[model samples]
Target chain A: MKTDMSIRMRTMLYGLMCVLLIPFVFPTWWMVTSSVKPISDIFAFPPDLLPRTYDWSTYQRVFELQPFAQQYWNSGYIALLVTAGTMIVSSLAGYAFARIRFPGADAIFMVVLLGLLIPAEVTIVPLFQMFNQWGMINTHWPLILVPVFGAPSVFSTFIMRQFFIALPIELEEAARVDGLGRFTIFRKIALPLAKPALSAVAIFTFLHSWNLFLEPIVFISTPQMFTLPQALTQFTDAYGGAMWNIQLAAATLTALPVLIVFIVAQKQFVEGLAHTGLKG
Target chain B: MANVTLSQIKKQYGNTPVIHGVDIEAADGEFVVLVGPSGCGKSTLLRMIAGLETISSGTLKIGDRIVNDLDPKDRDIAMVFQNYALYPHMTVETNMGFSLEHRGGTKTEIAERVKWAAEILDLSNLLKRYPRQLSGGQRQRVAMGRAIVRDPQVFLFDEPLSNLDAKLRVAMRAEIKNLHRKLKTTTIYVTHDQVEAMTMADKIVVMNAGEVSQVGAPLDLYDRPANRFVAGFIGSPSMNFIDGVVENGRFTAPGIDLETPSFTAGETSRQLICGIRPEHLVIGGEGISAEVSLVEPMGSETQVTFSLPEGTIVGVFRDRIAAKPGDILTLGVQTDGCHFFDPLTDLRVE
Candidate 1:
């Protein structure tokens, strides 16, 4: 009798979990399935969950519509730059804020944390004007620089700070007694042990830069200069009607690589974030 | 080996003071232990010597050079920490050799030094294992190896064995004492355990409330503490202090009175505290009558708690005493071993 009840409970739990997972999993499924459907089949009364026929031309048309490959490259490289840059800048600044005892460190850290309070929308006008004055408006400068150095990366900095703070202080002290200076100790001891936090920050920063829409739309003008999000929106027709198939194809192209990478290395992805001292 | 001298050492966290002016001197190759209860600033003092803590105001000298502003690397000192502090990411060999690698030593030299230290620490087979993979005792050996491989001018230990279980702690304590005997580097060890200080140090400095109460050989501090704090702190179970009045070569408490050798010392009106170690009290004759409260028997000796007219007192006896609770008994104190201190200042009034 107990075994029967436990088996029933397990089945119910699996059923509930799949239901809970649908909200997050459904949109990606719809996007992929609709991307390959014929334009007529896309809006069929049944609303195809799986297309009977694939519109292969729609995939090629996504690239033909406004330098889509270049836009993909722009998003990929910008995210790479942002991830690398944020990892360096935020880790160094975070470690300093957490450990080093320079004069006015706490005061400076408070000012840095104040970046969290001001929304990017509040500073977007100034940032756009500043980038324009430097003739970097049409370039990928805003997309790369804003997330790496601005408020977006502050959360990354906060995460790194939390991890570094929990690092056993005596490890660094032992490094000191081993005759290491502050910088050497940080590089050799503290940073290596901080791999989990760094991986978590890297994933978060990359995704943030990858999905950026507002900053790219505001700063970029040339269609060739557009990032993936901006390029995905350019698939509208002259009548201002949505090009559903083409846009879905481009959105899949933009989101697939990261999704596939996450799937393959999901253990590292989940465990890295879990151990980033964000357990609470 | 080098001598370390701290003259007028003081530490302050912003406006709040932690360590008041302290003067300590560790001779070349001497094993000196700084012992005190927790929050007494002994670890802070050791850290200041290791150059991990900034000396708020004072001159710290290693050999003849003043090292007050020098970095820890420039000071050439090694320290073993309470938690061992092995680098979690590095293998035991890499952790031991990491400092030398940073100092621009050749890879071969670094490896050779690491190998040498590993052999000494019996960590040869475990050199490739990371800290997380090793047992606590293994990690502790790696921490010690990291310190010794540098062959620095001095070594600082901040209660390095305090985290271990009792059996492991005793084993490690003897190993450390043997290591010190072999190397003979000038070392400053800090621990709250007086037994560690007693068994390992050539000299012991007892601290209380951030100030040194006494500095002497371990037995000297045990047999003749300079102040009441040291007397109470140096022995296990602590020395018992009894409040009393001294008049005309006699000291009188509530229920106990005793005669002492005549001395024309301090003011007779001044109140004093008399102290006796538990071991000095004996059963029977030439003493006061007391009510037995409790008795605890060890393999070699029994400790009995008794209530005298003045207050409660404990006596340790090697002979088996046929006494139980609620029985009246006479207790004698070894007169020569008694200590008197000025109650107000807590300083010995010998």
Candidate 2:
């Protein structure tokens, strides 16, 4: 990258990259265009990259067919709660494991990391039975609690711990010598300096909970309690035939808010993750 | 300012003890340096005094208070780490006044103190800059400025200048010494460089393998080192040691023959270790003879390494000899600065 390449080689390299970008770019292109297409034209042999004819009625059916407004609120609030909850739990656990000299900390951290190896699908049955025993099956507790305290949070904790470890020990020691106690040091020094890591944790936790599909279908039986991903599948006709255009419309609505958020904060989201540079 | 005292201090991790029982009495407003090789427990001792590391045993007292159980904040000492642990998020003023904020100082008082410290450290122009924005020397001064604002009983510096370039290190070294003179606060510095210890310390403690090898004024240790290790460690280019034995009235080695240095408990016909400083060797004198192997001209002085029959010895002389690698020279120790030790024990004879 330091040296300038020849004109032919640079052209070939950019050509190769463009070819590799198609599969990732085409699906989103189709998803947006198909959402606006008429149902009959959705199955056209040469798919309309841009819809040949528009139908605003499919978007109207998206709200009428289900409690789409309520489902939107459900997914939004659950993702927010899960993001905030995961941030707290992960930062506390990660700072303790990385900075404190507690006995058997390494052993406890290893046990916690085992959660990463076990997929949530592997334990969903047991979790459903437990939630049912507590009469919480139709509630959002499983949706919120599972992602916040379950395997998804372990990755956040691992990332936070890695960030906190690279934090210079002298800063905390200087804080201590400056008359700050352990909790005060964590609050004023550690937390303020952990913005990049916490932001990264927030984005990942939000997207994970927002796109959560399996837990919602298993836990919630009511259409009103459906999350965005669960509600996206409910756009079907009377005989259970897929309403392809309406389904795509609901999917677009479900994915739009998060996409907008990503676009708005993409710089911080990517650079915060890329650097994680605790250059203390 | 307060005098710091450590009586038989020790530190251990599990069952492995890194600092054996040691005692140091740093006078009020005095600068004491703990200098040693790496892993010699000098930094551990400094941390123990700073209350960053707990003492596994023994007593430590600052002023009149027994402070072994106190936290670092309560110990009333300020430490400047080698890395200059300035808060990356805060400006220079905020970082320096952070301690005063915790100690219940008002906003005006904190600002005044920060301003005063910044002025003293010549950092007034840098009050708003973050740590990463400052150069290495400026950051180091800000670190010292942070310590200065506290105005604590004692100042602890853990190799504060090790990260600077050579020229900056010398400049900062003088600045630190000048700061200590102005403040007149008790200071405890830890470093591995002997020159820093030699030039700056009012009293220097030389440690090895978790034990205090020797402790005295710098020149006192230099003039009359307690053992072969102290003699070899205190000087640059180190001292030349010859393994030999003393028989009757004379001590003799392969190319060294001199009168045996006498001590209180003297024994004739015994194994001995003779230590001669590089600067103490006199050329063209009525003394022992050896062949020169190399002549290193160092501007004001020249270093000559002589190839003895059994070993080699190096000498730094102010008088430049017209000598090459194959030249012959007569070399003799000026017994006034000569050191003799017990070969078996590696302890000083006197």
Candidate 3:
């Protein structure tokens, strides 16, 4: 009934999969291995599957070159704040759009959906001008505030709205009869049941905030204020010759937290996206 | 306990009216059921009483307070949804005690009430488990437990047993009825299933297309339906209506003629519908000839579908009928069991 593959068929399938995995997994493997390889051997023939000679000094040089730890903290805190802020804003907006009935709700939701149409690049200049007038340039305010409140969160709000819409309305009715007001019902019943969608939003907002290069580079000029993605490019010698091994080492460190987060929350993330009701 | 009264309660979605002024009164500790086929607005009327849906117009009173503008929580009522609507994330105890918690009950008080409700619902052992961990019937009991934990003034149930299997539905039906008996709380139950309405309701409100067709005690409605709709809706197999005219003390149609009841004699040479329950059709006697079209043996009773020259009618016989399709069977109508209705208005003609 299962129609399971034979062992030989499975072996061949695994072999095909391993071969297919090379394009996706090999880069991370190379980046990790290349971080430990001697600078001269990084581009060596056949591309040493393992490091030929270990150069632990590259990791030391990564920290010595710039305020690497400070930059890591900047990215870490910004991502966390963005994740939390986006979660709050999006879940509330989503709940309102999905559940609450009011005049012009549909029109307002359509306007919000318009945010999904305009790419971030198209709004960057206007946003930069707006933030400049607010004296928010060179601060983490733009990095955090824009994603949490602006276009980036539109997707999160959309996801949350879809999730909240899929939820049974009877639960809220029952909660209302249980003496919960709208806010209390949202907090106690709706929000607790929204863990999957929230996780999906968290992962998305965190990764988006962490990998943000254009915004940080455009907004932040201070060395210590650079996030990981921006800081990774700062690992250069005086002559501006790219410090290959040091850069790779910093990039490897930059990838670590995101990797760990995804590993920890992959189940919920997958389920959340799947349950977003996007599939036909 | 409180009595619920709806005086001309109406509802409309935008310009479209759903409940066109329904009036129902459930005396204190009475079990009232709103029942009808789908889209009959029975559930909507129940929701209006529970304060889930806004009443477009008319006065809704819980006890003596007009509750038209009050929130569901302020109405002092608890409802069990059709799906049970147990908070999936919370344990049974927390779910049962959620209302009390919202009302600022002390933890000890909440725990005591939850314990009492759990014990009554036989969910004491399962209080620590989540709703997803319980069976359909257990989840149903948990929903009931949640309702009873707060001891609200009234209870509302919206097809609460509909999600359960047949056996569980019957068990839970009795359990709910027994619970109502013990608590003696004013309860309004809504279901489309006539069997549930007939077996469980102290009074049944039969609705048709957003209007209350009849409201009476179960047997009273069954014995003497006020209208044709109530007669058709209150029975399991449903009453079969044969269109005929009463003339010279005989009800005559295309290929059928029968002795009319004494009360129906005054309407001579008038068009009428004679409604007869499936069980009231006698299999053998001096009567109209009908050819058996289908025979369904349902354990204790054999349900036979017969084709009278005018129309098809169903009959339930206690004795096992060996008649197959194409066999002619003489069927007599129980004279006392006959109901005469005006064909034009579909109203009972006494």
Q: Name the 10 consecutive residues with the lowest summed lDDT in model 2 chain A.
A: A271-280
For candidate 3, lDDT tens digit of each residue in A1-280? 2445577788899999999999999999999999999888989888879987888898888889899999999999999999999999999999999999999999999999898898888988998999999999999999999899887699999999999999999999999999999998899999999999999999989999999988998899999989999998788889988989899999999999999999999898899999897641
Please report the candidate that would top TM-score against the real structure: 3
Q: Tell me the tens digit of each residue's lDDT in model 2 across B1-350.
A: 89999999999999999999999999999999999999999999999998989999999999999999999999899999999999999999999999999999999999999999999999999999999999999999999999999899999999999999999999999999999999999999999999999999999999998999999999999988998778888999899998887776566888777764453225557777878899989987645679999999999999989998888999999987799998887876776756888887889886
Candidate 2: where are CA atoms >4 Å away? A1-4, A267-280, B247-249, B259-267
- After TM-score superposition, the amount by which residue A207's alpha carbon in candidate 3 deviates from its true location, in angstroms, is 0.8
Model 3: CA > 4 A from native: A1-5, A278-280, B263-267
Candidate 1: where is the Cα deviation over 4 Å? Answer: A1-10, A264-280, B246-250, B259-270, B320-322
RMSD (Cα, Å) for all candidates, in order, is: 2.6, 2.6, 1.8
lDDT of 3 at A223: 90
Chain B TM-score for the candidates in order: 0.95, 0.96, 0.98
Q: Find the candidate with the highest DockQ and give its number.
A: 3
Total clashing pairs in model 2: 0
Docking class of 1: medium
Model 3 interface RMSD, in angstroms? Answer: 0.4
Every model's DockQ: 0.73, 0.87, 0.92
CAPRI-wise, candidate 3 is high
- Candidates ranked by TM-score: 3, 2, 1
